[model samples]
Target: MNAVSAALDDKAIATGPAGPLLGDADFQYLRAFVLEHCGIALGDHKHQLVQGRLLRRLRALGLSSFTGYCELLRRDPHSELGELASAISTNVTSFFREMHHYDLLVDELLPRWLHEKRREGDRLRIWSAGCSTGEEPYALAMVLAEAIEQSGSKVDARILATDLSPQALETARRGEYSLERLAGISAERCRRWMLRGEGEYEGLACVHPRLRELVTIEPLNLLHPWPMSGPFDAIFCRNVVIYFDQPTKQRLFRRYAELLPVGGYLFLGHSESLHGVNDQFELIGRTVHRKIAE
Candidate 1:
């Protein structure tokens, strides 16, 4: 289950004094809307949980009840879709959350890619599909910047960090984090890449401009159509697909395959897999799949 779902599960399954109750019709409508627009499946037992979580959204929008929210959705689904997704989902991520993935890039992939791409003078792209805040892309940038600097190669390289939540994307754009959030990073890397703040911002650290330069943050809903067309070298979509149902997962992996060239890589969350979803990629490492010629 996703963080929001887990949070709801942790609760007593009671609405309590949380604004208004979510009626059956409105709850069903929300389930369908979420399933269609967000690709997340809401179970029958999730009624009370959805009610409890969405109360905050209702309060924010000055909505009196679930029926009003449903009506607003009916009038204009696009306007509030991202906010709805934000309310119902949780962004549980941290710097180098999965160290093994980084180890693979730093140890083997980056050197080889830099060498080959330098020879070919080709642009290298990596997409962080659900970059919650800035951590994933910035962490990626650290290694990527190190690789480029070490190889002395200026192969046009960039990391695309996209998330559906506006709030999350804004945090990513800021590229600043609390010092406590830097625990996942090593002390040497912290000294090298993070700029510590003083005075009013004493507890915070901002990403170096080089890391910010290498990362481009954008807002993108995966269920919606995409604007870019390209062969990315690798895609990190970790911990984002646990909410998606079977068909959604199938279509998403297929689209990822379309954007990745032969031998490109797809890095999934440790708990996620493409075993029955798609056959375009072969598993090469823990939760890492490489695209194969069909």
Candidate 2:
């Protein structure tokens, strides 16, 4: 099975008779609700996976039946939307998960932007559009911090990390991770950027204050209205649109294009492509696109 299928199937065991079973009508309502609110298209086969995942949520909310859960959504979808999306959607991410994207920033983009921005006094903004538990943005901040110091440029730069999952955003805000989670980071970066915990907090690592200062974490549902005005130099929306339907992808990419200037970059997941979805961005590198002048 594919990785996504495997992830969705993880721990998706059939509930016992003691627990409430997800009925067909309620399942359909959930499918539709998730699609409209979160932009994730749930296939018919995902019913059991959804049921298994949401069972935890049901228990948390003191709900005994799927009907009760659906009623909660009906009463106020926004109240439960983040928790619902967190249950259904996968947020598997890591520090420097896709290293090449960071390499591109370090080798080419950052230097050029710092140089140009130093001359023009323009601010640099990179949005980590689905930042998950903060690893990605912190990773970006490491490279960005290194670039600024090396270039000796006083270019105002920052990374905006946003995600829809309340739980994930809470972890991101905390910025602490188990030592094992540091595997993806290089040894030098780990030494330089990670503060090792002690005594009761042993085996945990916290990000340096510089990374926190560079990244602004916020809660954002990509399908909903965005509060920030833009002309962002680049956007890292990796592994996010894979769940979106065609129309949703089209709308999201169009919105992204509107916020990016001509020649601005859009970095996507390794498995995702803009082909036959959006024509405003030209393929510039592996899983990278640049906005084209109209």
The residue ranges of model 1 lying beyond 4 angstroms of the native Cα positions read: 1-16, 119-121
Q: Taking the tens digit of each residue's C-alpha lDDT, what string does model 1 give over 251-289?
A: 999999999999999999999999989999999999999
Give the least accurate 10-residue stretch of model 1, judged by summed lDDT: 1-10
Segments in model 2 whose C-alpha atoms lie over 4 Å from true places? 1-18, 119-121
Clashes of each: 0, 0
| Per-residue lDDT over 1-294 for candidate 2, one digit per residue giving the tens place of the 0 to 100 score | 322223333344335665767888889999999999999999999988998999998888766667778877997899999999999988999999888899999999999999889954679999999999999999999999999999898887999999999999999999999999999999999999999999998999999999999999999999999999887999999999999999999999999998999999999999999999999999988999999964
Compared with the true structure, the alpha-carbon lDDT of candidate 1 equals 0.90
Which candidate wins on lDDT? Answer: 2
User: What's the TM-score of each model vs. the native?
Assistant: 0.93, 0.94
Candidate 2 global lDDT: 0.91
